[model samples]
Target: MTLIYQAGQAQQTGQIVPQLFVSIQQPSQVALNGVSTQRIGIVGTASWGPVNTPVGLSDIAGYRSSFGEKQDGDADMGVAVSVAQLQGANDFRCVRVTDGTDVAATGTLSGVTFTAVYTGTTGNALTVSLSQIGTSSNWQLTTSHAVLGSRAYSGANWSSLQAEVSADGSAFIAVTLPAVAPALATGTVTLSGGTNGGAQTSVQFVGSDDSDARTGMYALRNQGCAIGFIHGLTDTTLAGVIGTFGMSEGIYMIASGPSGDTISNAIALSASVGYKSYGLKMMFGDWLYYDDDTLDTVLISPQSFVAGRLATLAPSESSLNKQIAGIDGSQKAGLVSTGSSKTYSSAELTELFTAGIDVVCNPVPGGSYWAVRGGYNTSLNTQTWGDEYTRLTNYIAESLAGGMGAYIGEPINGTLFGDVRASILGLLSDMRGAGYLDNTGTTVPYTVVCDTSNNPQSRTAIGYLQADVQVEYMGINRFFNINLQGGAGVSVTVSNG
Candidate 1:
């Protein structure tokens, strides 16, 4: 029998036709019984056969000659399956073939669970219902749209807009949403065109807080609101338009030029409270009873003066010295006090006041009084001289009457030890000589108290007595000379007078 190959095809069988796949087998002399070897368009054919007809079969089993040719010798006889026929059978297809194995559904969103997906040549759109369960159930929508405005950039385009959401909708704050994909250079990118239109609308009932961490609005909704930045009012052409600026409050506006817009009363009110910054100006007010910078035009009652009672004089040499040395006859008293009422700055009047303070007596009528004629500092950290300089300068410059005086001794106790002692003696002597102390040149006992309690350097006790000389000078009858005479005396009388 000649083995052949057959390619199977679906036939209109009353019963379900089982697909047959056949190949040539070895039986050279006789064909398998009850098997119809159908030729499959080629010389090689296939047919149904009994299960055990061709037993002990091999590639070459029977030897015979075909088509009236008797075989005297073998002529390379063997069984072979037609590779082309086998291939055609492999490519066979069944009617109404189910294609559920290899093909996949197109356009699957990787991490999204879409309740419904609409795909078309136009575009693909996914409808995701917020789920209380799966990842598709709960979600945060990220979009690029400006819900709030910014001064830096304008227009409806939200290239810089951001949004966010939370569990609570009422407190739905603004958030920064990622920017949408830019339009392709080709232009006209299609979105899902459906009843939904593929455009996201009220996906969120309300927006959350702003995600712009630098924005003033973000600061307010957050906690401490401040914009430590500068922005331009116009297009960002030149970076020079903006500069480094700061504001404490969340909301602030900068304006320039004298426009019709006046400053809000809130600004002035806040300024009075604390240091606040505006565009170019700053407002400040204090407890000194000032509401605004401008002077109040309203008529108001004058402030009443508060009087100060003088401290009681203690019985001490320094106190006595201070009493006598500080004493100056009134402008109208004694003689027509020949003195310069004209005051001068410490630098200008330093010589006169210094000389008077040193000599302990300046008989120049009204100029003889001791006063703080201010001085200037020659070096750093020595404000004493500067203070004196400023004081004397200001007093002489501003005084209505009397010429300014200088301190008799240095401001510090230890610094002017001898000067202080000598100044006391000289001042008392000058007073006595001028008859301001007494009517004659008799050596009058000027009770001088030496209290060391307030002294910086103490020797014996916190409170103790130290003897100091008290001298008296006289205006001589001859030559009208100012004479300085000294005499030795001891502290003997203690009268508490």
Candidate 2:
């Protein structure tokens, strides 16, 4: 919409009519963006693919396409993704890690050669072919990796033809050549001599690389749909990083507690546990089930299951009392023991839950369910550690921020500001009606304040706008009581008679 041209003399009515279109300024919708509480994001190692790039995946097919199929212990990402997706997770964004040299296949024509796009041991089996169009220098070149199939290109590159590089291998690039060129021969050429680096470390999984477009869990930040990602690999170092960044960025994280030490460590940490880990936006997991296939209590973190379960439920819903997918709750269901049997009494488990360990339990012999108890929260006034409260607040606030983000650069006026205010109030009202906000007789649900008092001329001149929001996070009744008194009335009836 560049405004061009100087004012011209009234040439003719018809000439000016083309530029006389009326412009209308009317009311428009700026709906409050609701943060998705049902989506999960994750990052883990894979067989081979680009490192540190987020790939949206919904099923095993998506995983296989973006990241190659799993092989042996290279099953971390696949296993977690399968568990989450099967359990009804909304979607997963995975960043594959195959830190290795890309193997290449090459064929020289007229002293010009084509190379493999990525360096990897998987590329060693790649085959490439280029056919000269008869006696002409115009040629068609095709290259493909052992794992990744062929990429084709049709062109007249007098000099060299190469694989076009991309996040996903698709196109090919070539160099300009001289008018007079030597005839080329067509043949299948295999590539070799590439290597896969080693296994990924915790730092690599929950990374802090400044240069990465979206580093680690931060990838979930702007994605807007993901509530958070499960690091899956429960390295304490990785946990600490996610704990710090998740709260700061308004993203959440589901991580596995320290395996053997969780029991003793959780008990010892007690009230100071959240302080020890600044447990604002992180939820820790506990023992799930034994994999009979491997004849062992599986060490696979329950993060994915919990995440998927949470995503499936209402945003206001407490993850507590929810059924975790695939967890077989049994005291002595003949599950082989890896160490001491994973059987504990309800009293013992309650202590573990209060002390901050999300123990898996089977109240009824065959029905396994997550206690959803352990979390790092210092606030004793509320069940902030339950993660439901944090999620509610984050969901509401982040949603408001997202909705209002569109209006930032608009001209500041009472109408604009009032629209923004109404949008927030309406959103919160819907939240209250949906049971996502606290509207009980006891508490105020939410308050939104934005007006001239808050936005003055001086502040507006400097491009400053402010609003104050207060929200009362709803609480869950985790404990219930029942009692009977017979002495007060001194009347007792034998109903059995």
Candidate 3:
């Protein structure tokens, strides 16, 4: 993209070159835009809403609007959304899935029956009233729930509107029509035989059928955002989705292990699907406040918080030990508790940390939420991946991709290669200053290999451009030691061990 300016008036002779009184567009040294690391997504069943579609919501209200107001049968979705919002996450996407066989209730008047508009339990509360609009056979049916509305019909028999129109309904009773030619009689009616077939299985969650746009996970394809969290899907199911259906566009999928799922189970799931490549980070049993009225124990998914935390932090900082927003101060919320009544010992926490499972501990002195174990990982090979590290590499890769776009189809020449190398080095220098790289003005913490030795004629002929980036992201100091030395004068000095 190039810009040309034509705003300077013709000056007499070589007048003092006015600084153009314009904004001087300098070549950007700092990356103007970086790969977005924040956008989070979730897939699950809503009490009421469209199925298998990615809806980006602004806040709790936005979510409720798209996924129907949260209510019974919402599972942990409402809690997760609340937690996510509290964590400063304003950008999110939700996928709603429901049984296709579910049926809504219906009301009848003058042979005309109106069925619930959508299939969900929330419709069971509808109150449809059948009353004469004036003083004639012409009657009006009004529904309490907005899911349905008032309808006017003129028919002598209740079955007259035989063509069943699924208008809408609620648990409230539907008023029965009067038998007289012109009268006002109302009776509550409960449309029976409505059954929500079943809960969504793991397979159903991976909806690939985009025909009607309701393939659970598949509904988020080309969603144009990195999926920060996979929500409440099981480990095995998540593995299947990642191993089978991949998350393109360099997105990582945050997963969770509920009460029953063991750390080993989560690890096996990670290994089974080649999780390293898939960028799947599993959070094994983090804590959250369940009941607001009375304290109650419930397994709250941590993937949402993990996503929000990472999204909330600077690209160079880690989301570890960060307090979750709401639960930080909730008296009911406590740390590292498991359903097995077993607390993970210090050593066990160490093991889980290496295995790519994030854990939570008690509140940091002034913090509110439970502290997140560093919230990212790859496989069980502990040394290989870190969230911020992986994110840095991803950003650089994406940045380089756009930075090097000018040479996409140009001839493979020295100038283009040099330009690409310079761009890589320049970005690395910026990272070094930002603390993403550990270069100490001497030792380079990264290696960018793009010289002729590797990219020879044969490789370039096949239309392949490659960059080998090596980054040594800093790791947590799990162990440290100090030695104390005592002198005859009763003086003690500390020395590094």
lDDT of each: 0.21, 0.58, 0.58
Model 2 per-residue lDDT tens digits across residues 337-443: 43324455678666665554454444423244344544333233344666666567668767877777877787787877788788888888888877787666665
Clash number by candidate, in order: 39, 8, 21
| Stretches > 4 Å off in candidate 3 | 1-32, 72-76, 104-118, 122-197, 209-214, 235-249, 260-278, 291-298, 328-343, 363-369, 374-378, 398-407, 418-435, 438-453, 468-472, 480-497
Return the lDDT, model 2, position 112.
Answer: 52
TM-score-sorted candidate list, best first: 2, 3, 1
Looking at model 1, report the run of 10 residues with the lowest lDDT sum.
301-310
Instruction: Give the top-scoring candidate (TM-score).
Output: 2
lDDT of 1 by residue, 1-497 (tens): 32246423323346453454345443211111111011111011011111101111111111110111111111101111111111111111000111112121122122222111112211122221111223232233221112111111111222222112223232112222233433112111112332211211111101113454222212222221111111101111111111112122221111111111122332333233322222111101000111111222211100000000001111010110111121222221221144433333345334322221111112333354421222111112222222222222222122211111222222434434444444455444544454434545344746443335434355523433243433222221211457665557644556886
Q: Sort by lDDT, best first: what order?
A: 2, 3, 1
Selected candidate, larger lDDT, 1 vs 2: 2
Query: What are the RMSD figures for all models against the true structure?
Result: 51.8, 7.3, 8.6
lDDT at position 149, candidate 2: 51
lDDT of model 2 at position 416: 73
Which 10 residues in a row give candidate 3 its minimum summed lDDT? 162-171
